[model samples]
Target: MKSREWTDVGTKLFLATLDGLADAELDAPSLLPGWSRRHVVAHVHHNAEALRRLVSWAETGVENRMYANPEQRAAEIEASAVLPAATLRALVTHSADRLAADFDALPAEVWSHKVITAQGRTVLAVEIPWMRAREVAVHAVDLDAGAGFADLPNDLTAALVADAVAKQNTHGNLPGLAAWLTGRTAEAPSLGRWL
Candidate 1:
């Protein structure tokens, strides 16, 4: 529950993911339709940068979008995909570090600030690290690194399972919490199915 602890999970997960992948493997498509491993990594990198911006804006008493906008954020991940594998890896590495630094620099109380994301959802600043951690951990599997919800520690996997369940109603036919976390489902449940 500590802010640093959450960030540490993200940092460690990302690093472990990096170790598991090869340059060519990063661009390979996984189970997510039309998305390569690169896409997943880009999403995580951009997400970190976006969180840094969000936290900074919150600290300054300025209400900025958690992401510039949905389209804009998507464009960022696509842009990162243009880089060669090595360059993309470097970008992700640095972005992760910067994100952790940003989180570490926040005043202890600032983690409690509420911010509205581009998705039109409001979440506390302290929750950002958990958000990023899930991204890295789940997508690490998308890259076919042999990591999965089952690979995560029990506590983290339990939390992710809960989140996957809570998101099921709004997001549509997604791999239910148990399916995804337990590897019973191969593809993510279709968001449109529930919608």
Candidate 2:
């Protein structure tokens, strides 16, 4: 599969979900606690921008971190979350387009260049698209616009499930997860919020 195919399918799904929301519905709370649909939309746009910066770092041979810091990311989302629905939609769509174009223009040799994610993991530049795929696919559901994980492409869904589970393991409380997966516990493990 092309590195960005996951991104392509994810973006298509996310845009469709966002399209189903009405202007007034943007103010409604999303499946994500405390975030309205507008906040989800805004975060989607900023995520694209952040990933694009990584692509730029790869393309230009300059170091560009995804965000200055965690607070900058949170601040950007909170500020953009209050914009008019139409404006937020247009901005997100444009950002996605811009990120795709940037990805297409990245040099083949640069695909192997290292970049740091907002999460602070050093990954190959090629992983940038998958990073975006994760955001859009999950946030589409968080929008609470009648979309769900089952609506995503099967392969993407599998990849997301694996990624999310691996993340939980990395966070270092695995006994609960192991017990639940093995059916030794009736209750599923409690996890921190999804990114």
Candidate 1 residue 20 C-alpha distance from true site, Å: 2.9
Model 2 residue pairs with clashes: none
TM of each candidate vs. truth: 0.82, 0.96
Model 1 global lDDT (CA atoms, 0 to 1): 0.73
Q: Could you tell me which 10 consecutive residues in candidate 2 have the lowest summed lDDT?
A: 1-10
Question: Which residues of candidate 1, in runs, are more than 4 Å off?
Answer: 2-6, 171-195
Per-residue C-alpha lDDT of model 1 across residues 74-113, encoded as one tens digit per residue: 7888889778888788878898889877877889898888
Cα-based lDDT for every prediction: 0.73, 0.89
Q: Write the per-residue lDDT of candidate 2 for residues 1-195, one digit (tens) a residue.
A: 354998887898899999987899999999888888898999999999999899989888799999999999999999999888889999999999999999888778999999998888999998999999999989988988888999888888888878877888888758888899899999988788865
Clash counts per candidate, in order, are 5, 0
In TM-score terms, which candidate is top?
2
